[model samples]
Target: MAFESFSEFLAMGTHGPYVWSVYGITGVFLVGMVLQTLSAKKKQLKRLHSILVKDVSEREK
Candidate 1:
């Protein structure tokens, strides 16, 4: 309602670049953080599994 058209809405009355850039940066960081968390979790699980396997094998001896 504030903007007359789609292009005008995107322009955001001369603040488009700054506003859109901030949004883009935030989205990138959010995605990066999610991916990093998943990767770290996978690595941690693998490490724990290895430690448990080693412990069990030692117990068998």
Candidate 2:
């Protein structure tokens, strides 16, 4: 498809909003998933560290 002018290209034949919104939502969802995974990993590591310390202390006594 070829546009006669720049404006026509941006309008995208009146489907611009729907097409752009899909892309935007996809990007946001990907970013959110990454952040959530990182925080969960941090929480898991902290919990594991405390559990290991407790086990070592019990064995000493």
- Please provide the root mean square deviation of candidate 2 (C-alpha atoms, Å): 3.4
Give lDDT: candidate 2, residue 56: 100
Cα displacement (angstroms), candidate 1, residue 53, comes to 4.5
Candidate 1 residue lDDT tens string, 1-61: 9999999999999999999999999999999999999999999999999999999999999
Report the number of the highest-TM-score candidate.
1
TM-score of each: 0.70, 0.59
lDDT of 2 by residue, 1-61 (tens): 5889988877789998987789899999999999999999999999999999999999999
RMSD (Å) per prediction: 2.1, 3.4
Model 1 stretches with alpha carbons more than 4 Å out: 51-61
List the global CA lDDT of all models.
Answer: 0.99, 0.92
Give model 1's TM-score versus the native structure. Answer: 0.70
